[model samples]
Target: MIFCIKLPGGLIKWCRVINFKESASGENPGNLKTPSCFLPSSKEPVRFNLYTDFIPLQKIVTNPNLSL
Candidate 1:
């Protein structure tokens, strides 16, 4: 899952949870602990719409693997 977290200096940044480790012997069995692998976004933030600015229309049409 992607999250927008505020840092100590009140800066907002994007990060993604790569792994979810479940807590053992806890009150809730299905409860999840902190993310084992948290990956920060490397790319710069976009100002416009992602679909229009980030991805090219030509690539989207030619690349069959690309999905909306």
Candidate 2:
């Protein structure tokens, strides 16, 4: 899975999911693992649960008035 995060400076960070960890408790049941940066960079991937540090991005409908 691809995760995109918008920084405070209006920069978007794109990362690829590396692994997943399962949990029995907590608001987020599972965690997603992703690299801190893309390849060619030397940062290790980190694990974060959904709804905590990040959430799934949903499709935006810019034209609600426009007919499909």
Candidate 3:
């Protein structure tokens, strides 16, 4: 799965790929945060849209041979 985050006022000057770490243990599982993908402005409002080919989570997680 890929996320398409939209930024207001052309704030997305650059983006950095990051990997999020899963939570250790709690009601919230498999939650993680990526290092901030810096924007050009701090006051801009941003929106995110996630996209995927509708591949099953099992296929996405299990297939090490697949290339993004």
Candidate 4:
């Protein structure tokens, strides 16, 4: 699933599905298994707010036929 986050200035950022896995027995309830990156640019440094909370697959479905 892809997650689109809206920034303060109405800019939308997209996060692709890099990798995923089911939680282990002792793992945290809502943790992402993959590490995400910020887009590089010529401007000053960009800081992003990361959310580890797992959103349901139904919420971010831009295309239902596309594979994660």
Candidate 5:
């Protein structure tokens, strides 16, 4: 699954998710993970639950009025 984070000032970021079972069984750990620059600090972690299918990149790129 891909995750899109809406940051302050309306910036968008995307990342692909890796299930732990897949990673534990030796899937490409680095490839499936979010880039280090996208991660929050350990001292003030951000957390949330995903409840919907991922938003497609095309929709985001093509539409100017969509809001999460």
Candidate 6:
């Protein structure tokens, strides 16, 4: 998934969130602080909304068990 954090001065930066692995590549995971930088291909898709100016959008409920 993609996590986008909006800065105080209207600056938006996005990061790819993923599960933490003890050994991503048998290398010291501690050395690699940013795991997203070494993600494999075919990752989840992320969209950059053109009209959203740090405004929250209404959640769409598709599942019958979901609620607002």
By lDDT, the best candidate is 5
**Residue 4 in model 1: lDDT:** 64
| Prediction-by-prediction clash tally | 0, 0, 0, 0, 0, 0
Which pairs, if any, clash in model 2? none
lDDT of 4 by residue, 37-63 (tens): 333431342333234444447756965
Candidates' C-alpha lDDT: 0.46, 0.43, 0.40, 0.44, 0.48, 0.42
Q: Rank the candidates by lDDT, best first.
A: 5, 1, 4, 2, 6, 3
* Per-residue lDDT over 1-64 for candidate 1, one digit per residue giving the tens place of the 0 to 100 score: 4556555556787664433323323444443343323334434332222224357778888996
Candidate 2 structure, TM-score to reference: 0.31
Which window of ten consecutive residues has the lowest lDDT sum in model 2? 33-42
Q: TM-score of every model?
A: 0.28, 0.31, 0.21, 0.32, 0.30, 0.25
Q: Which ten residues in a row have the lowest lDDT in candidate 6?
A: 47-56
Q: Please, what are the lDDT tens digits per residue for candidate 3 over residues 1-68?
A: 22345556554344432332222233334333322233334466332212232366678689967765
Every model: Cα RMSD to truth: 12.0, 9.5, 8.6, 9.9, 9.0, 13.0
lDDT score, candidate 1, position 14 = 60
lDDT of 1 at 41: 44
Model 5 RMSD, rounded to 1 decimal? 9.0
Name the candidate that leads on TM-score: 4
Which stretches of model 4 miss by more than 4 angstroms?
A: 21-32, 35-52, 55-68
Model 4: how far residue 10 lies from native, Å:
1.0
Off by over 4 Å in 5: 20-45, 48-68
Model 6 per-residue lDDT tens digits across residues 1-68: 45665545576756554432433464665634433422233254443332232233443334445443
Between prediction 2 and prediction 4, the one with superior TM-score is: 4
Tell me how many residue pairs clash in candidate 1: 0
The TM-score obtained by model 4 is: 0.32
Q: Write the per-residue lDDT of candidate 5 for residues 12-41, one digit (tens) a residue.
A: 755444353454356756533532222342
